[model samples]
Target: LFRWDGVRDVHIWLWETGIDFSSVIASFNCGTNTFAKNHLFRRLRWLGHRAASHLATLGYLAIWHGYHLGYFVLFLFEFGCVVAQEQLYALIDRTPGWAEFNAKPIVRPFVWLFGRLTINYAMGSTFMTMGLLKTKYWIGVSVRSINMFTILGCNSTIKSAFYVLT
Candidate 1:
């Protein structure tokens, strides 16, 4: 279901609506590429670009699906997840010790599993909810788990950064 909501669709929508496809699609379609580029302010610029691109896609999706509250709520949820993941990935990249720690044979599987689950949980609401009431209620209920996982990930990342620095 989420697979059907492709970045290509978002690009087409933005094109139809007279917006610059390059700006939004750059982050939305090639996120890792943008994230990997070397520049002093890359992270800061990517964050802003990501926010705008996500919001634009969410708005288009909401309108496409009849402008329900679920779309908005799901947008908020996804935005948080993407930002958190970006920060964590950046931290893991910058801290060689943390990166090596996570890459160990005994630890890598757990990290992979957790990452898959977190991404699915972040997107599950959009696929599950239909109407405004159901969307709002479901988001309210499910967001607790999403947020918990996010907090846990962020705490671990921050701690790893601190440990590596010290």
Candidate 2:
């Protein structure tokens, strides 16, 4: 049921809103990119790497937003998501037979469902943090969310191990 075309619907809705959050984000991204290219990348070659550049850009956005700790937490969480996504794609590409397995018609729906659920969970957590500007509450939520992810990761690992043994 879920398809990439649904993303276009989301974009259309956002455009209809008149106040497009994406444009704001894009402006910030452009500013960060220019600064990174002119100042940061020139001074530090290591920071020119993709991950580091994303970190720097997100950090800049966090600071630009305000002095609120929640802002920093939100952007950091976003940066982590971006990094995780890149790593996941890279791993899928590098693992022998994994890419083909994931691409198989029978497996595609499950993959789409998993990806959508994960993205929705992340977005919900992020929006919750965004709404709660107070440091104490947002920190508690962030820590709890991190713990949940950790537990989920451990469960997946255990399940995989059991499958291997069986």
lDDT of 2 by residue, 1-166 (tens): 8556434323343233222223223333454556656775455556546556656666776787787877787776665555555556778999999999988999987876676567666656666776788777667766777778777773443243233323
lDDT of 1 by residue, 1-166 (tens): 3466455433444333322223333434354434333322343355465455555555555565566676566555444545556666777899869988987999977876665565455455554554445554676655665476557665463344334323
Locate the minimum summed-lDDT window of 10 residues in model 1.
16-25
Off by over 4 Å in 1: 1-50, 124-126, 130-140, 143-166
TM-score of each: 0.50, 0.63
Q: Which ten residues in a row have the lowest lDDT in candidate 2?
A: 15-24
Assess candidate 1 and give its TM-score to the true structure.
0.50
Error of 1 at 142 (Å): 4.0
Mark the regions of model 2 whose C-alpha exceeds 4 Å error after superposition.
Answer: 1-46, 154-166
